[model samples]
Target chain A: MNARNCLEVLRKIKDVAFATVDEVGKPQVRIIDVMLVEGERLYFCTSRGKDFYQQLERDGNVAVTALTPEFQMVRLNGRARRLANQKEWIDRIFEENPSMNDVYPGESRYVLEPFVIDCGNVEFFDLGVTPISRESFPVGGGEVSEKGFVISDACIGCGKCLRGCPQQCIEEGTPFRIMQEHCLHCGRCFEECPVQAILRR
Target chain B: MNARNCLEVLRKIKDVAFATVDEVGKPQVRIIDVMLVEGERLYFCTSRGKDFYQQLERDGNVAVTALTPEFQMVRLNGRARRLANQKEWIDRIFEENPSMNDVYPGESRYVLEPFVIDCGNVEFFDLGVTPISRESFPVGGGEVSEKGFVISDACIGCGKCLRGCPQQCIEEGTPFRIMQEHCLHCGRCFEECPVQAILRR
Candidate 1:
């Protein structure tokens, strides 16, 4: 599936494991409800009085992962931009999640603010599919860079890197290419290359 | 539930969203399988050639959260200590997870290493239960410090701190007390305390 479809999986599985770095640089994670998924952007809400709110305000960088009942995993790494003029979104959130009213009754719900992740790197892994297919793509709008190692023209077709690759994703050809989709990006091939042919992307 | 039971939930869920800080201090999260659970300790394995293994080696500090099908979330924060002797456990891991053989055949399995979280802070939250029950406990050993704010005898029955508490967890008493479980720990009450009675733990 494409990046937008991957994000759609996040919307289907509303409960996501959201992670953020604390002031001390330790990773903190908790299950957060996905308030809304409009186009390629995903939105979430937290009270201004909560630590989660403070962490987002401080760092903005966050990672979210969700596992579907079918065993598919979608992980997104992005910066959480606080949505301005949240008056309309807050009402939308309350209307979308009525149970939230039980937690924050009446005007107290006004303390909640909405944050949106506009764009970032996303990895979608479908463990339920045969061969466990997976791919990484960019969400929203950005240049998506190939993450795994790439083979340069310096390769003499020695086949050493292929032997060293744990995933065996290297192909036999002139200037052997590493399969970006299957590569683990372990850097083993880069270390094993005699001519230093492998370049990390 | 207690610490042991919280860990049990993690084992039952098996796949957890594990969070680790990258070199740049941004939080990174992915789904990882719990290899084993002995007592309060949880063990996981990853190939030494992978970036995940390198990050753990660089900073053992990690956070793991798993949500059960019933909506129970178990979050554990702690340092991951690499096991010294892998010969014994590696064999056991392969024996327990036969599918791993398909991924890493023969001696290639030796690339994998096991890490254990022996002691940590664990929070058990069950949204399936009424009132959204939640509790925090220490796993393995050491003191279980109160997570949020604590009001000492210095409170002097002052109710000013109560007004500043966002969660309204503070109650009037001989010495005003903040409900540790419900406290947001935003330090609003601590800052507003007239007698400096609120202490963060």
Candidate 2:
């Protein structure tokens, strides 16, 4: 479809997969509720005290995947940050999603809830870039499971999967080790490897 | 309709009403091309040194409305920000709409083209604040010019419309003025307004 058409499709979807990298160069992925999208700015509220926020502060770069149940996918690569600790910001989010109020009671507690949106929360790491449309995204072919068989040698010294591993079954030594029993078979490590070092056996 | 079904309906539409503010406290509204939507993020590109980006940066808050030719409406509110300026970022956008490359050649010159998206661009800006919904957004309001209109009171003195204005009809003053004659009536100012003070006259 056209560019406007692509946006229309995106405005309809809700869930997004947010991927982040930590100081140690480990990747973490989480399925988050998208709060809003304007222009190229994508906004979400997360706990500033959480690892995600911490990782963001360290490295604002991030990738967000927007997929429709019908198989339409758009991958957005941008940056994120914490906007404000003001009560007005917290109240705005609470007003939009009152259910959040149940999770956070007082304004003091609310400020602690991470009511940050992109307005001031984040800025684009790349200032002179345009937004990509859905058709151009690397047309992902298959869905990778959470866990996969690991193969050594291809490791680039970047420990992405090791950190993404939900069970922490993968170990990082000279070559790294995978505690097979501790592995939940999510295979996320295999899927996220930049060099495809982790093989599904 | 269910959210999924709602998206399906949203996919069939074109032409969105965007509301933003100009520099002199005037509200501007218009319909512009929506590049793509992934999750809550709606991607679009404007000139690097444009009024739209200036106002957007000043205030990330914005409202976007898209209506289907078949009488469906989708409204979103979120914070806007420029995406990172990088080759990969620009390439991704070009991948989607190759035609953009024609307008913007790949190079530092293209850096003047700014990619923007809104993360806080949430749906239901007035869901709890006022009373609005899928029906109230004027889905079938046919033939209404998708032009930008800006009122003076809310204008933040950003002066964005002067350059992008096809007719060069925008005038900046104590309260920004739009020369109705030279105006193409393509309400970019209204849609780009950070504040909602702009409305159809």
Candidate 3:
């Protein structure tokens, strides 16, 4: 529903896929813990001695995704920064997550660094719903990315996009309208457009 | 330990994170169903009109990851091809996965096409273990990528890398051996090496 709520859902899921690009431009992903979620900010930690850490340190850009048992999915893509107060943040993370102590006992926990993701886009998609609802928004003053397709004003109202849509989310209007919340963003409509009125943004 | 077994584990998990790069080179991920797994191959379906389908059509590159309840994770990064026998594959898929019928009933199922990943790298990582564990291999005669860091034989045996390793999987040997199975590929050892004996491939 909201960025904070979506982050909370991710934190609840705890173990989610954290994806980053390797040095060779190959996508690398691993299951990571979402240690904490505070307001619009989310926190996580990885051992500084791990490849996951190196990738994060070098790239900073990250995409995290988790799906709940209820079929609700939350995706967050943005940049994460290693916290300045390493020890303080790591200690706080450990205190909140006691299970981590078993992995890194005592002072050795410092080997792990904490990172924060406070700005980015958050998309919530629910497959449990009939129409398959979706909502995406930017948090922390981040710019919203123009993803999927946008029908331009050049529309002749041919209704080709409506017919090609899998979800039947398009409706008749002056230039026809796309119900984005229920749209699949499949680009089928974009491809089926006769006059190139549907543009990818 | 093998690609087939790892893919079976993913199939057991069913709902896993499927990662792909978008048109602009940003990571996009979602919870995708592993509809079928036969031999060393894996299969899944997406609506022809979806961005996910488009991404796969343009670029066959994909990374799929799933973690079991026991903390065992399977990662498969490979290229998927659209099958020529779409209808036959879809019907077989539906027979194996009946629930898909609910999502796309009757003739609407034709909108969904099947893709298979038969060749690529598969890595099995188990976090439930005490020291953690990992094994990676190529499947379907695919070339194994040189991922992570490898320590060369220019060993001074300074023990810095061993001390710097978070998993303590390094040992005293001719080259100060790193147990690849337990190595985090974190680059800490590479950074700690004074002679730059460690190399990343």
lDDT for each residue of candidate 1 in A69-157, tens digit (9 for 90 to 100): 88888989898989988888889998988977766656656667889997887898766644455698888874465565789999999
lDDT of 1 by residue, B1-201 (tens): 788888888988888999999888988898888888888899888876566777799979889998888988898999898998887788898898787776665665666788999888898877675445568888877346455568888887768777655456788997888766665455667777788887766
What clash pairs does model 1 have? none
Off by over 4 Å in 2: A1-201, B1-15, B106-109, B112-118, B121-201
lDDT of 3 by residue, A1-201 (tens): 789999999999999998887666666788899999999999999876566787889968888999999999998988888998999999999999998876676666777789999988999998887777899978677656756777888899989888766677888887888888887666677778899988775
Give per-residue CA lDDT, model 3, range B1-201, as digits (tens).
788899999999999988877777767788889999998899999987677887889878888998999999898998888999999999999999997765665666777889999999899988898788998878776766656777788889899888867678888988788888986666677777899998875
TM-score of chain A of 2: 0.50
What is residue A145's positional error in candidate 1, in angstroms? 4.5
Record all residue pairs in model 3 with backbone atoms less than 3 Å apart, i.e. clashing.
Answer: A50-B186, A51-B186, A186-B49, A186-B50, A186-B51
> lDDT: which is higher, 1 or 3?
3
Highest TM-score model number = 3
Per-residue lDDT of B17-82 in model 2, one digit per residue for the tens?
444544443333333346555543456655433345455667654445544433234544345566
DockQ of each model vs. true complex: 0.47, 0.01, 0.46
Ranking by lDDT: 3, 1, 2
Q: Model 2, range A1-201, lDDT digits (tens) per residue?
A: 433233334445643445555444433444444655554344466653345656567756555544454434444444455665556655666676665544334432332333222321111111122321112321122122222266588787688767665445567775667675344333556666798777665
